[model samples]
Target: MGDTDGAEKLLEEAFYNQPFNKDIVTLVFSFYMDTADYRKLIKVAQRCMAFHLADRLCWHRLGTAHFYIGEYQSAVLAFRRSLEIEHNPKASFGLSQPLLALGLYEEGFNRFEERFVANPSINWIRAEKMHMPKWQGEPLAGKSILIWSEQGLGDSIQFSRLLAVLSAQGALVDLILHPHHSDLEGVLSTVAGINSIILIAGNRFKLQRRYDYHCPMMSLMGILKLTPAIEVANEAYISTPASHKNKWFEYQERPEKKIGIVWSTALSDAFLKEHPMHAAAKVKKSIALRQLEPLFHLSHCCFFPLQIAISEEDRQYLSKYDNICDVSEKLSTFSDTAAMIDEMDLVISIDTSVAHLAGAMGKETINLLGYVSDWRWQQNREDTPWYASMSLYQQTFEGNWEQPVNKLVRLLQ
Candidate 1:
C-alpha cells in the first residue's frame, strides 16, 4: 500500500537525524511543495538557501515561496539572485507576476512571453502550433482575427471587454472558447464585433475555420498598450438575454435587497496539486461558511448562495439559515448565474467566477480578496480597474478574514 502518512513520518525522522543533509532537505521541500504547504515550504526553502546561498535552485524555490505569500519585493530579489547565477526561463517568468501586480505593465508584458516557453501545455502554446501569424497592434480594417481563450473562465470574462474595442476597429473577430464556456455563447454572441464562437472539444478544434490573423486574448493588453487609466475607464460590456433576466425575477420572491455570496472556489485538489504556484492564493481566496456567519446576522438583507456545486457540509450549514437561500440547483449555466446576479442588489464573494460575472454585469459587488491576490486585483487598493461598480476588500494579513469580514459587516450595516 502507498501510505503517504508513513512516507511523511519517515521523511521527518530523516530530516531530524540529518539536519544538514542536502538530499533530505530537498526531499522535504519537494514534499511541502507537492502538498501545498506554503508556510512550511517557506521555512524549508529559507533553510536550504541559508546552507546553499549560491545555489540557483535554492534561490528559485525561495522566490516561489515568497511569491506565494505576497512578498513581491522579496520574490523579485530572490528571482534576480537566481537569474544572476544562471539565465533561467522559469525564474524570469516567475519575476513577471509581481511586477505586473505592482503595475509595471511594460516590463511585465515584455517578459510575459516566458509563460508560453515555461509551460509547454498552455493553450497559447498549442495555439502557436497552428502556424498562424499573430496579430500585433496593426491596422485590422480588412483583416479577420482569431482571439483564442486562455486560462480560467474568470480571465475570459474579464478580457472579453476588449472584443468590443477590436470590433469597433472594423476587424472580424473569431473567438475560440473552452467547451465549459458554451453557456456564454448566447451572451457573448450579443457582443457587437464577434463573428463566431468556436468551442474546443475532443478533435473538434482541428476542424475550426481559419482567420487572417490570430492573437491570445491576454495579448490584447500589450497590443492595445493598456494602462490603468484606460482599463479603469472601461465600463461593463456583458449583456443578459431578456428570457434569462425574466426567468430569475419569476423564480424568486422579491426581497428588500438580494445579496449573492460565493464563499469557496471551484479549483479542485487535483488541479492545485498540478499547479502548486496557485495553491496559496486558492487557499487564501476561499473562506469557510462559518467565517461568513457575521454577514448572515444582518437583517432585511437576503443572502443567495451563487455557487454551482455545494459540499454536503456547506449544504447543511446553509439549511440552518432561512434568510440564506440555496439557489445552486437552479443555476444550471453561466447565463442563469448572470441573470440571478442581474437581479441582485449586491454580490459579496471571494475570488471566483461569480465575482467576474457579477462585475462584468455591472452589479454592485464587494469582492473579498486574500492578502496576496491575483495580479488583476493589484495591491493595496479598495477598487479595481477591471470593474467600476466593484469594490475590493482585501485581507490585512494572511489567513485573517476577520478584518475584511468586519469591514463588510460595517458596510452592510
Candidate 2:
C-alpha cells in the first residue's frame, strides 16, 4: 500500500545478519524511532547491547525505549550506562526525563537544559542566536530584564512563577512573547509587577524599551536551582482580571458540582508542522467527546467545554450531549478561560494548558495523565508539588483512557 514496501524487509535482513554492526543497528534504530515502535526497538537494542556493550548510541536508544514505555528505573540505568560510556548531550537529555519523573528535580533540571544541544530545533536556541544576554546570578534590584516563554502555552503559564520572584526582587521585569502569541499577552499581562508585555515580531514599536537582560522563562529554574513548589513562593502567580472574572459571574449557579472538561490539546499549526510526531501524539492524549458519554450521564455534575478550536466532529459530539455546554466559543483569551475555570467546582483535563491554568489559579483540578506523562507530572503520585490544588490520575494501561475516566467518575460520585 505504501512506496517503501521492500525497505523494511531489507533493513530487517541487514540487521539480522549484522546485529552488532553500529551502522546497521543505527539504521534499524532510526526505522523503529520513525515508526514509534518502542517495544520492538527495546528488543532489538537489548540484543545489540548484549554483544556491543560499549555502544553509547545503543544504550541511549535503549534508555529512550524504556522511558517511552514508563519504565523509569530501567531507563535511568540505561541512560546512566550510556553517560558512563560517553558524556554526550543526547544521553544527558535522555537521562533527564526519567529522573524528573522520579522526583529528582535538582539533577533533572540541570541536565534537561542539554535538550537544546541534543535537538537544536528548539525555539529558545533560535532566539539565542540573536545575542540575547542570558541572566546568570546577577543582582536583580534596579535591573531591567525581559523573560520570554520557551515551549508551549502550558509551560509558559506553569513557569511564570519565576517571573513573580524576579518582580518581588524589584528587577523591573517584563514578559515578552512571539508575534503569534499576542493572545497570551492578555493572560500574562495581568500578573503582578510586570512592567510591560511586548510581542517581538520584528516590531520596533514594542522593542522601544531596552532590556538589561533576556532569559527564557523555563531557564530560570536551572539558573536559580529552583524546584516546583505551590504554596511558598509560587502560590497562584497568574492573576485573573476582575473584569474578566465579572464576565463569568453569570454562570455561578453551582447547585451541583460544576466541572469543566478539556479533551484535546490546542497547539499552533506552525508547531504541529514542525513536529509531526507530536501532532500524532496529540491523538494519544485526546479523548473523543463521544467516548466521554458516561461522564455526561452523571446528572449531579454539570460539564463545560474548556477547549478552543473545536473540531467539527467534536462539535457534533457536543451537540449530541446537552450537559456538555459549549462555552469554548466565549473563551476568546486565556484570561477568559481562567475566569471560566474560577466558576467551575472541579476541573478535569488531560495534560493541557487548561489543566496548567487551573493549577496556576489554585483551582481544584484532576489531571488525567497518559501511562507515561510528561516529567512535570512526576510518577506514582496523586499529588504534584507544582500544583497543590491539582491531583493526578494516571492511566494504568497504555493507550487507554478508560481507567482514568473511571477514576474521575468515582471521584465525582
Candidate 3:
C-alpha cells in the first residue's frame, strides 16, 4: 500500500511463489477493485469461489466488481449472499439495482425502501424528523405535490418534463428547481397544473406548506411507465427561449439547417483518454470547436459552438477552422444552449450535457457514443426512450469512434 510499484512487485513474487492460493487471489481482486481496475477485478472474480470468502466483504466486493463489469445478475446473486449472511441495508440497496436491471421493479423497489434511512450522513445533513409528506398512493384529485430537483443540471432538466405528467394526473405541482435554472422558470411555469415554480436559493422549506406528497423529479419517469416505446411527450411542450429570438434574427440568412457540435464525455479522464479517436478532445474545448468545423463549412448550415473558457491550445486548434463562427460570446447557460439548439435543425455531439439538452428540447439530435456507454443507454438501440428526438451513433469497436463518424458522414451525405 505504501508504494504501488513496490506493492505490485511483491504481490507478483508472492503470487508466483504460491500460484494455487485462492485467498491471495481474492486479496488481489479486492485491491484491484479498490484501485478502480475493473478488468483485473473481473479476472480475479471469475477465479474466486463465492462461498470460500472469510466474510461478506468478499461477496460485497465480488458483487461490486460484477456490477462495474455489467454483470448485473451475478452482482444481485453475490449481494443477496451478503444480505443473507446478515441483514445489511446497504447490501439490500445493492441488490435493488441488479434486480431493477433484470426488470424486477416491484420487488426491487420494495427492497429499496429498506436501504432508505432518515439521514444516512451525520456531517453532510442532519437527521430529519420524517415530516416530509409521505406519498400514500392515494388519489390526487386536488392534492398538491412539491417536486424537488436533486442531482446535476442535466438530470434536473431531463426529469423536469415529469411536471407535466404529474400535473396531468390531477396533482398541483410546485417545482423546486435549482437557482442556476431560474431562467427556465418562465418556461416551466407555463405548463398546465404547475401551480408554482421556485428557485432553491437558500429559502426555508415548510413541511406543512399545504403539500399532500413530495417526490424527486426523476422518479416520475418510472412511475409513469415511460419506457422507450411508451415515451411520447408532446413535441410542442417546451417553451421557446426569449433571449435567442433577437440574436437569431440577424442570422436568419445564415442557413436553413444550423447545428451545434459538442464531442466529449465526462466519465473519468483516464477512461476518456483511452479512446484514441477522441484523443484530440483532451484539449477540453477542442471538441466543441473542432466538431463544429464540418457544419461551419456547409453554407446550407449555420454552426454554433456552445461551450467556452477553453485552454489556449484548444483555442489555437479552433482558430485553424476557417469557417468557425464564435458563439462562445453568446452561450451563458443550459438555457442559452437550449436556445441555440431550438434555432438549429439538428445537433451532433458526444456523450455530454448538450446531448441531454438537445434531446430534452425535442430537437433531432445525433449522439456519438463510445463503445460502452452508461447503463442507462443499456446495450442496444439506435434511439433512447428518455429522448424520442435523439438518435445514436455508437462505436463498433472499443476505443474507436471512427465507425460512428464514418456512419455520420454517410448519413449527412
Candidate 4:
C-alpha cells in the first residue's frame, strides 16, 4: 500500500499477531518513528521491553523519540536506561543536549566535555594539538597572555571585549586574531593591558615561551558572566586612516539616521545541516528575498550586501528592488566593510559578520532571526546578552517572514 496509514494499519495487525518477533517489531517500530507517530512508537517500544526484546538500539530510539516529542524528562530516563545496558555514544550526545536545554548546566557541561570522545568532529579527530598555551597571571612585569579566536567572526568580535577587560586588569595580552580582523589589531593593541597583536595566519611572533594562559574566545563570556545589563561605549572602537578615504563626512554632517542593511545569509549550508534553533528551516531564494524586502523600504536605511551572487532567483529578487545596493564585490576585507558600516547610523542585518562589525563598533543593531535560531541565543528573548546595543527580531513561525518583517517595519518607522 502506498498510503502510510494503510501501511501502519497492516503493521499493527502483524504486530498483534507476532508481538515477540524481533524482526517484525523492529520494522514496525522504524516505520512508526519515520511516520512521526511518536505515541504509537512508544507503545511498540514498551511492548518490546515487556517481551524482553529491549536492546541498546531500541532504548536509544525510545529516548530520542521522547526527546523529539518534547518529553525531555522521560527522554532522560530512557537515555539512562540505554546507557545502563551499553554505553551508546550518540545517546550520550543526545542526552547532553536536552539536559542543557532544560538548564541542567553542571551535568550538561560535564557531558559537553565528552563531545570529542562520544562523537567528534572531523576537525577534532584530525586537528593538531598546538601545545595548549597557558595563561599565567603571574609576573605583570613581562608575561604575555594569548587570546585565541574561536568559531566564527561574530564570536571573535563578541569576545574581543574580554581583551579590553583583561588588559585593564593588568595582564600583558597578546591577541591571536583572524587575519580578516587584523585591521582592528592596532586599536585593539592600544587597549589598556594589551602589549602586542599577532595575526594568526600572517605574522610570526618571536617569543621566549608560549602564552601563560590560553583562552578560547567564547569562554570569556561565561568568565565575565556578561549579561545584557553590562554598560558599553556608545561609539565606534576601531578606526583606520584607510577607512577614512572616500568616507562620507557629509552623511555624518546630516541629521538623518543612516542605517546599513546586510541581507545575504552566511554559513547557509552549515546552518541548514545542523538545524539547531533553525530560523530559516530551508534556503529558498524567494523566501530569503522576501524576508529582506522590508529593510530596503526604510527611508533612513542604505541597503548593502557584503556579498552578491547567491542563486539566480535571489539575484532576480535583488533586480526587482531598486534600493538594494551591493558594493561587496568591491569590498574584500573587513576594513572596507568597517569603513562602510562606520558611515551608517545603525545596522539591520541577518546573523552574519556585519552584525559582528556593528556590535563591535557599538552601533545599534536589530538582528533578523529565523524561527529556529542558534543554541547560543537560547529560546525567545528580544535581546542578546553578548552585545549591549543589539536587539533581536525573530520569526514567530517557520518559513514565514511577513509577521516578523511587519514588526520590523513598524520598529523602523
Locate the minimum summed-lDDT window of 10 residues in model 4. 277-286
Ranking by lDDT: 2, 1, 4, 3
lDDT of 2 by residue, 311-359 (tens): 8888887887666778889988888888898889889999998898898
The residue pairs found clashing in candidate 2 are none
Q: What is the lDDT of candidate 1?
A: 0.80
**Which lDDT tens digits does candidate 3 get at residues 45-77?**
554454353356657777776765567888888
Residue 26, candidate 2: alpha-carbon lDDT: 83
Q: Which ranges of candidate 1 are over 4 A from the true structure?
A: 1-22, 251-253, 269-281
Please list all clashing residue pairs in model 3, or write none if there are none: none
Worst 10 residues of 2 by lDDT: 200-209
Please give, for residues 1-413, the per-residue lDDT of candidate 4 as tens digits: 66978988888999999988778888897787656566788988888888888898788888877765556788888888988998867878667766755656546545544555565541211222546443433443454566766456665665566676676666677766655556555435434445666665543444355655665555454444443235433234544335354554554654456667666565456655555323222242124666666767766655655543365676667676655655556565566667677777678777776776677667788887766554445457788665667888777775577877788778778
TM-score of each: 0.90, 0.90, 0.77, 0.67
Residue 93 Cα positional deviation in candidate 3, in Å, after optimal superposition: 3.6
Error of 2 at 409 (Å): 1.6
lDDT of 3 at 30: 52
Clashes of each: 0, 0, 0, 15
Better of 2 and 3 by TM-score: 2
Predicted structure 1, TM vs. truth: 0.90
Error of 2 at 336 (Å): 2.2
Model 3 quality (TM-score): 0.77
Better of 2 and 4 by TM-score: 2
